[model samples]
Target: MPNALPWLDAAPVLAACAAVAGFLRPRRGTAEVFLVGAGPGDPDLLTVAAVKALGRADVVLYDALVGPGILDLAPKSALRVFVGKRSGAHAMAQEAISALIAARAAAGKVVVRLKGGDPMMFGRAGEEIDHLKARGIPVTVIPGITAALGCAASAGVSLTRRGVAATVHFVTAHRCDAGATPDWSRLADPEGTLCVYMGKEQASAVRGGLLAGGLDPATPVLAIENGTRPDERRVSGPLSALPDLTAALGGGPALIIIGWAVAGAEASSPVSAALAG
Candidate 1:
């Protein structure tokens, strides 16, 4: 979660098996499956471990968030399938997606499930893992740079800074179909940071809850849209101004960093000079 040694957290998260690697050694008798993270939107953000897996893929099941220039890593003959919402709208459901993976692996093919962010972080990887395990498929997981860390460094925003913020919480602002949304009052910490993922659709709810939870209306909020890529942009203002900020952002995927750590800070990446302008 800290800026330094960011990959330390990536070492052992939801991943327990050795990776299927590059052209050095040919894949063995048993074909393995890989669940890998593509990282925010930058191909460079991919880890060495993930790259090796991609090289060995027989068939890659990729999501909508995967950026351009990434699929080139796969072997030329490998089959690339787009299995995301944007591709089919609602035609391809999660169950069908899992079944597709199972069918391919059952045929003894090397499968790589390439998701946008870290597979474990709200990528629905757990369901896929469960499905694979039930069908006796071999699977490996590889972690990638989450959008929060990628955007923070690229945009010059620190989620956690010494003497400014010590604790950082990653919460989802997704509009849930069932159950209550996040408890904002319990999540607010003056000395801490809040990184909201998939938050643009519900920015108003986030703003209202934080204000009602005792966070100052003047508390700073910084949002990095299309983070880490060349077209990245930024917007920042007091918490009360989230609605306008959310409405103004392009249709690209975005994340929000909330707390004093980002207050009045100019973006380091080539982002908007000011929230208003």
Candidate 2:
């Protein structure tokens, strides 16, 4: 009976195995935060630094504008947090999200704040940096292609040219407060380009502002929705017709480009005929 090989059931062995696994598990948590740009919508546009940071992240808090494909870059074990903001629907308040991120980093977790387009471009990276730095948290930033540049390339247009558009400017049609209004007088240069971010919903205001500020009503305007994405579309018309063009784009993140640069692009480029009215 000594050599019967049935001396033990599997219970103790399984318990010991579980104990060993718990003992061998790697300790999790680090003390660093990376602010990474996910580019407009194309994963191919992500910078190498962005990729490396995502690969090492213990948690990624990303914006709504960031595409799903970019989220795939994070490790399987990494915690993905949706700290996204849409038209009026913000998953979490900015202050709360900042606190959460700072708290997590203070807990020594490797965190990544993934935003769409260049983080410095209306991404509210400055606020985040201030929040983390106040707590003495180390933060790193990785830039990616912005939507304006991506749209220009995809739409075969230039924001500035030698003589056509001597200067190019970027602005956000979304005011920080209800009483705030952009100084349209400074942006009414027909010879200059104005690229507006978060501009779709306020297209009427944009049109009226530019028109009231003496910009040429016939100045060409272009709206690119989901730029650099496979479903990217370009709608072009005169400044006076910008409202119609903006409405045509439906619901999607878009940029409004205004200037002779748009006119020049349409003149020489072969864009989709279906995009024209």
* Tens-digit per-residue lDDT, 3-93, candidate 1: 7875576656435433332322455656578899999988999998888889888999998878777899999999999887531264368
Superposed model 2: Cα runs more than 4 Å off: 1-29, 264-277
> Which portions of model 1 miss their true places by more than 4 Å?
1-29, 86-91, 267-277
TM-score of 1: 0.85
* Model 2 C-alpha lDDT per residue in residues 148-197, reported as the tens digit of each score: 99889888988888888898898987766786768877789988999999
TM-score of 2: 0.85
Can you give the TM-score per candidate against the true fold? 0.85, 0.85
Error of 2 at 59 (Å): 0.4
Output the number of the lDDT-best candidate.
2
| Model 1, global lDDT | 0.81
